[model samples]
Each structure stands twice: as C-alpha cells, then as structure tokens.
Target: MKTSLRILIVGQNGQVSQALQRRLAGMGELIVLGSSQLDLAQPDLIRAPIEALRPNLIINAAAHTAVDQAEGEPQRAFAINATAPGILAQVAVDLGAALIHYSTDYVFDGRKPEPYTEDDTPNPLSVYGRSKLAGEDAIRQAGGQHLILRTSWVYSTEGRNFLLTMQRLLQEKPQLRVVADQVGAPTWASTIADSTALLIERWQRGQPGAWGTYHLTAQGETSWFGFAQAIGESLVRQHKPCAMLEAIPSSAYPTPAPRPLNSRLDCSRLLREWGVSQPDWRSALQQCLAGQA
Candidate 1:
C-alpha cells in the first residue's frame, strides 16, 4: 500500500464493482477489467493481465451470484466463485498484493436465533452459499494477506435486486405477498463501497492484521414484508403509488433455492476493527430511492 496505490477491480459491470469504482475515484489509480477481458472461468487468463498491471491491491467483485440458478449449475458456480477465487488468491500471493474479496450471508444455515458472527461455523443451505464458502476457504488456504467481507441483501439504484423486483411486481399486480418470517439486513451497494474504501485506507496504514473474515451489512434487521412496506410507503410519499404489500409465510412462495429464515449478521468485529458504524437501513434505502428518482 502506497500514497496512491495501483489497484485492479475485477468485474466492471457488476453493481458492487461499479460502486467500488465510484468510491475509489481520485484516491488511487484503479484498473477495472471486465469478465470479457479476464473471465473468472479461465483462471490462466488472469495471470497475464495481473502480472502486466502489477497492482499493489486487487479487489475481486466478480461472482456467480444467481442463488437459485446455482442449484442446477453447481459446477459453473464453483468454477467462478470457488476455483477462480483460489486462482486469484494464488496470483495475489505470488505478487504480494493485498486482496479484497466479497462473500455472502447465505454461507450460514440461518437456524440460529441470534445474529451470525465471523467466527461462527458455516453450514450453507444452497449451492450458491457452498461455493462462496469454498471460495473463502481457498483464499485463506492460499496464505495471502486478504479480506473476506461477508455481506447480505445487496442492492442498488441500478441492478436486479429485491428493491427493483418489488417495484416491478408492484407495477404489474395490485397486491404483492412477501415472506414476513425471514429476517435480514438490506445493504446498499454504495455503503459497501464506502466501507471498502475505509478498509483499504486502514490496510494502507500498516495496522495489525485486519485481514480476516468479517460480516458487513446495514445496522438493523427487517423482514421481506417490512422492507416492502417501507418501500411502498416511500413510493406513496413520492406520489408514485404501487401495489399493496401483503405479509405471508415462506411456504406461501416457494423458489428453486431454499432461503434462510434468518440472515442477520453481527457487526461488532467490523466496528471494533475498522472503527466504522453502519448507517441505518432506512437511511440507506432513502439514499437508494432518491438515486432511483
């Protein structure tokens, strides 16, 4: 890490990657390579470009994140999420570059009543989660200076996510039924990018090993019904009304991939280590909605 670190951001088109680009603007010289240039499936392709750039820091935002789709396509998911990340970790190790990787809350089974911490033993219920967990293990096994940030309910102003999905359903139907039992935090992409930048700054400061798995999400928790209601309320306030959001059980709506009943993550380690306090989900949602407008 230098005064102006030479950085590489993988997955340019993804929401998280795009947000990272915006957050790192003017702070460092960042080179973003899309999947077209360096496909995660072809691990060998990464070496040439990475060795060429010789970046001081590498942030991997690329991932096969389609949850349900992963169930049928486990190999494809593992190829990009698990195997590719392992290859990247080795490359970073060879180059002695600090690696920043993103993970997910789905790694846990969501059976616990309390929020999950970084130290909790993972029991991923879906293929997507298993692949992500394997990726984390790969990074750690590579024995490199790395940061594995596990986040939940990622969304943005522009992207296919819960927020946009709800908005679309609201448009098509007069009433929408969302699962009210499952609990989790709705984290904005911009917030993750900001927090990432702060972590990078800390990494540059030469602090004692802040390189470990940490769960980063918005401050509080909310169910799908609660989240939808908040969004509907916002839409009503803007006079752009939508469908009536209704609460229902998980059994009411079934999907290809099984979802966790609880996705809440504990953020104590992140707060203590990075000296960062997350903004409330309501506030972050407002920022996102305002951006949408």
Candidate 2:
C-alpha cells in the first residue's frame, strides 16, 4: 500500500487473481504468477520468487479449490492450501512485506443458525475446508502484517465457478435440481477485487489495524435454488435460454465432500473497520452479466 509498492499476486488465472489483475492495475508494480512460475504445490519453489521480487505486498489468491476432489487428494490439498501459505508468510516476514490472503467460509462447519462471525470457532467439515483453515492459522501464526478476507460462493464469467457451470447446465438440460437447504451470499470476483483495492488504499494511509481476518462478500444471502432462479432470470433478460430450476435438499446431491448448509458470513467487521461495503449478490450478478454482454 505504499505510494510505489511492488505487489506480487500468487495466482495468475484463477477468478480472483484475474479480477485483481484488472483492479490493481496502475496501483503498484504488479507481478502475477501461476503454477508454472511458482507452483504452490512445491513448497521449495515458493520462497525464491518471493525473495527475488522482494515485493512490498504479497497477495495470495491461489489455493487448492476443488472441494470434492480434495476428498481423494488430501495430501495435495494440504500441500498447496496449508503448507504453501505458511512458507509464504515466513518469507513475507523475512522481507518485511505485508500479506493479503484469501480464505473461504468452508472453514466453518455450518452449524450456526445465524451468520458466522470472525470470533466464532472454526470447525471445518471437509478436507478442503480444513486445508483452508490450516492456511489461515498459518498466516496468523506467522505474526506478520496480514489480512485474511474470508468470502463465500465466489463466481465470475470467465473462471470455473458456479455461475459459469449453471449457465452451461441451464443451456444443456430442460430442468435443474439445485440444493436449497444450503445458503450463502454469491460474491462476484470483481467485487472482491475492488473491495480489496479499497482496503489496500486504506493500508496505504497507514492504518495498521486494517490487517486482520474480515468477512468480505456480497450483501444479501440466498439458497442455491434461489441463486439458480435468479441466474436463470438474469439469463432470460439477456435473451439467453435457461433451464427450469428445482429446489432440492443437500442429501439429494451427494458428493465426496459435504458442503456447509449455512455459508452466510457476517461482514459487519469489514464495514465497521474499513468502511468497505459490497453490492448485493443479485445486483453484482446483473453487473457481471452486463459486463459479459
């Protein structure tokens, strides 16, 4: 956040990373690396690039994101999600650079009836969740200048996400069965990137207290069914064909990794501390579709 800070983003092609590439332009000397340049799965490959770049800030947007796939590949998940971040945090500490890492709502087991806060104890339900939680713990334990922004239901037009998947499925099938019991705010990647830029600006103003875990997502919450219905409606408005969406329970759509029923995160802390408020999910979606058009 310094006037001429060099920012090294850890992921190159992921949804959030791509959005960050667009959003963080002209803000700093930005360098984005993917697995080819800095394979996070190989912990040995992480520190050297970071040390060579000696960036003023390191934004880690990469992770082992396959939720169900992680169930079969726990070791690979932990290696990238947990171990890599710890190493990166240590490197950041050595270089005296601040770190901004992204985490997920999956860290919570989804037992709370209401929205989960930062103060709530995390009880991850699956390998992916546990791995992400581990990365958060590693960053905290590193004791460096860092911000862990926990978000939920991330999607974008370009990446492999729910929005894209639904767009494809809706076109292919006459009807779709989406889980209704599970709930969360569908956060757009660009929203996260823009909000993050605001936080970076605040940090540039020398607000040391801005470095901490905060719930950063779109404003409103909805179930998967509601989300699908909204997406279909949006597609129709755009003159695209969309399937009939049906509400179903989580049990109906079985997967190797169990998803959280309540993925809603309380984002008051971010607003209270940094005055960063995101648009509602529906509005964000409309904007995303408009951008796509």
Q: What is the TM-score of each candidate against the true structure?
A: 0.97, 0.98
Q: Which stretches of candidate 1 lie over 4 Å from their true place?
A: none
Global lDDT scores for all candidate models:
0.89, 0.93
The candidate maximizing TM-score is 2
RMSD of each: 1.3, 1.1
Q: Candidate 2: give the clashing pairs.
A: none
Give lDDT tens digits, candidate 2, residues 1-293: 45678999999999999999999999999999998999999998889988999998999999999999999999999999999999999999999999999999999999999999999999999999999999999999998899999999999998799898988899889999999999999999999999999988888887645578999999999998998888898879878888988899999999999999999999999999888899999999999989987
How big is the positional error of residue 229 in model 1, measured in Å on the Cα after superposition?
0.9
Candidate 2 to truth, TM: 0.98
